[model samples]
Each structure stands twice: as structure tokens, then as C-alpha cells.
Target: MPVDFTHPWVGRTVIYTAAHPNARPEQGIVTSVNVEARIVFVRYGAGTTSKATSVDERLQFLDGSDLILWK
Candidate 1:
């Protein structure tokens, strides 16, 4: 089974997902961190290698080159 999204590890990881089944680093610049929403709003650009993506349920199984930020 995939790790629980509520796990404390979520804060340590960059982009959370079930595909990786592990914590991965973000490749972009995080403009804002929505702790209440548990979502990271960032700008997808070159400096941040990863593309821009709005994660509905980042803790879910979504996985890709998208970059996100967390608090």
C-alpha cells in the first residue's frame, strides 16, 4: 500500500505521490505554500526545471515532472 498522505514525511518531501511511493525533490521555485489546502503553488520555469502543476491531492498517486512546494 502507498504511504499515507497525512504522514509527517509529507513535509520533508518536495512532491508527494503514490507513483514514486517515496519522497522526491522539487525541481522548481515555490511561490507559495498552502498549509490549509496542503498544496503548493509555484511557477513552472527554467530555473525550476519541473513544470507547473496544481496538485488536487498531492498525497495521492499522481506523479510526473511537475514541481511543487510545501511548508
Candidate 2:
């Protein structure tokens, strides 16, 4: 499914779970969104660590899916 760039979830904090079984989860703030491209960029590890990072991820809206919005 395609992502909605204007969704309220954009610019919020979220946790991302990789589709791979062994991948570790990440927490970050949503930086940008591209509905047409189905991509979301997140800026993670801010204030929690000295080094912060941003990651580009594919949007997945399916229930019980890999990536999800963090409450």
C-alpha cells in the first residue's frame, strides 16, 4: 500500500522493525515522507546518544507488519 505523506503520523516519533528476522528495531522521529515513492525518512537516536542517524525506510501499513508507528 502507498503511504500518505500528510498523515498525522508524519513528524512523529516511530519505531521501525526491519523485515528481516534478525534485524534490530530502531526508534526515530519522522523527518520526511514521499507518498508517491512510498518512502519515509526518520531521524533516530537524537538526545539518547551522542551520535544520531537518519534512515530511509519503505512504508508498510499492513497489520502485524515489520515497520510501525511508535506510541
Candidate 3:
């Protein structure tokens, strides 16, 4: 299914499970939405090592089924 970029995803929490089963899942909050680019930026990390990644690349636009969005 195509992603619905029209939704206000910012501030929503999302779980990102890496493609590799051995990798731990990361929980993050949506930081930004770029509908034109079809990219969602997420901020996630532990302690002082905060980081961000484009959801489209990290989750493959949901094609990998690695993202669990929480309302």
C-alpha cells in the first residue's frame, strides 16, 4: 500500500525494526514530514547518542514491514 503522507505524522511514535533479525528495534518520534519528497525524519537514540534517519531509507517506505507506527 502507498504511504499516506497527508497524515500529520510529526510527534507520533514509531518503532523501527531493523531488517537484520539480530539488530535491536529502535523507538523514535517523528520529527519532520516532507510530503513532496515522501520522506519522514525520525529522531531516535539512547543516552547522549541521539540520532536521526529518514524513515523512507530506514524502513524502506514500509516495504520492509519494519516500521510499527503507534497512534
Candidate 4:
């Protein structure tokens, strides 16, 4: 499905990148994340019925990435 960019998906994403070198990432829910720069950390696919890829492996936990806020 196409991610609603104008909606509230930025902080409600299912993934988070590491700030430091040793920090880890959080791959929470896969149905609520956007593919932008500020809120998103990676863009490995597009469009509906996209090839299922794990967030844990699709995105890298490196420096200069954003964080994901969950409830």
C-alpha cells in the first residue's frame, strides 16, 4: 500500500536507526511507517504488494539516522 505522507506516519513508524556506533535499531510495526527523509531512514521499495522485506535487514543502524516513536 502507498504510505500516506500527509498523515501522521512520521513518528508512528515501525523502524528506528542508531545514533551512535553501538546503538541498535527498533523494528516495531510494519504497517505504519513513511518513506521520507526526516521520518524515514531507508527506501528499498515502492508501490503496493511490494516484495516483503524485513525492516531489521532493509535498514541499517548507522549514524545520522532518525528515530521512531512508539506507544
Query: Clashes in each model (backbone N, CA, C under 3 Å)?
Result: 1, 0, 0, 0
- Model number with the top lDDT: 3
Clashing pairs in 1: 28-48
Task: State each model's CA lDDT, in order.
Answer: 0.42, 0.51, 0.56, 0.39
Once fitted onto the true fold, the runs of candidate 1 whose alpha carbons sit more than 4 angstroms away are 1-26, 46-71
Question: Could you tell me the TM-score of candidate 3?
Answer: 0.54
TM-scores for every candidate against the unseen true structure: 0.30, 0.47, 0.54, 0.24
> Best to worst by TM-score, what's the order?
3, 2, 1, 4
Give the residue spans of candidate 4 off by over 4 A: 1-15, 33-71
Error of 2 at 40 (Å): 0.7
Question: Can you tell me which runs of candidate 2 are displaced by over 4 Å?
Answer: 1-7, 47-71
Candidate number of the best TM-score: 3
Give per-residue lDDT, candidate 3, residue 40. Answer: 64
Better of 2 and 4 by lDDT: 2
> How far out, in Å, is residue 65 in model 3?
9.7
Per-residue lDDT of model 2, residues 1-71, tens digit only? 45455766566666666679898766666655544444565666664322122233533332324443432
